[model samples]
Target: MDIMIAAALVMRPDGRTLLVRKAGTRVFQQPGGKIDAGETAEAALCRELAEETGLRVEAGRLRGLGRFRARAANEPGRQVLADLFLLHLPDGMEIVPGAEIAEARWVDPAGAGIPLAPLTGEQILPRWVAGAFAPQQAG
Candidate 1:
């Protein structure tokens, strides 16, 4: 069975994106979680952002970036379908890793030099490079 999730491409003004590593996991990914039944994708994402990163973002702040499908990063023999969104974080916003998140990083998308989730490496980053979700380019 495929996992259904909501993910965020969190961007900072400095051309950095936020990625999170789960506890005991090495592959870094966009911070998000499984969408609950009867929950809107935006709503689930809002809840997930707060849970994983201590960011209280309203649903209105999430710009839908459409859906992407890829192999599950941590689960073998399973696929994942993600409803992705773009979230431009405010300046000086603090990110405190919470719940199962072990570390949060601000990375230059061009060369992170870290192991990334398949969804991030294959689907998201390519699109990001194409300026699909990024509304503003940092100089």
Candidate 2:
């Protein structure tokens, strides 16, 4: 079965993206997670953002979609349906790294660092940074 989800492409003021290390673990990923059964993808993004980062986003235009087969990092071998968005973070919200998150860090999207969300690194993000996926294809 496919796990439906949503996530944010949260870029900081310094051009770095916000990535979270899963709590009690080392897998790095975006703040958002699986969308609840009755929730719209955008609603899920907003909800997950606040839950994971203690920040709220008004989830604007549709940004893109992330499709992949989940692997490793405790979520091995499941298919994922993710809706991605460019979000706005509330100013001054501290990163508390909630239950599912161990640490939150902002890093250069182009630089080397901890591996990002498994499928993201291999698809969306690289293409995102390279301008391969334009805003027109958001929805």
Candidate 3:
């Protein structure tokens, strides 16, 4: 079965991204959760971010980063279809862990030391390191 989720690629000015470990989970992942029935992806992301990270974000502030499919991090034999977004947080915004989140941290995209969800480790990190989502240069 495929679980539909909305995830955020939360970035800081220093070029590090945020990852969270949910309570009882070993793999760190982008802060998000399953989309509720009738909810848009952006709306689901906004709600998940607030619930998991205590960061209230306006849906309009999120930029579409593309969707990714990977094996579910905590659920064996399950797939995850994630709608990802690029979210740039303002300097010094404190991220408090909420709900199921056990811990959160900022890590360099190139060599994140902790274990990561397949979606994060296999797909998202490589794209980030290659600057696939970097702002376009104007000629």
Top TM-score: which candidate number? Answer: 3
- Where's the lowest-lDDT run of ten residues in candidate 3? 130-139
Give lDDT tens digits, candidate 2, residues 10-103. 7655556788888667667766888888888888887887788887666564354544444434466776766766653445556776767888
Candidate 1 error regions (>4 Å): 134-139
lDDT of 3 by residue, 1-139 (tens): 7999999989888878899999998999999999999999999999999999999999988888888999999999999999999888878999999999999999998999999999999999888898787762110
| C-alpha positional error of residue 40 in candidate 1 after TM-score superposition, expressed in Å | 0.9
Clashing residue pairs found in predicted model 2: 23-102
Model 1 C-alpha lDDT per residue in residues 1-139, reported as the tens digit of each score: 8899999999898879999999989999999999999999999999999999999999988888889999999998899999998888878999999999999999988788899999999889878888776553332
The global Cα lDDT (0 to 1) of model 2 is 0.68
Q: Kindly indicate the candidate among 1 and 3 with the higher TM-score.
A: 3
Evaluate all candidate structures by whole-model CA lDDT and list the values in order: 0.91, 0.68, 0.91
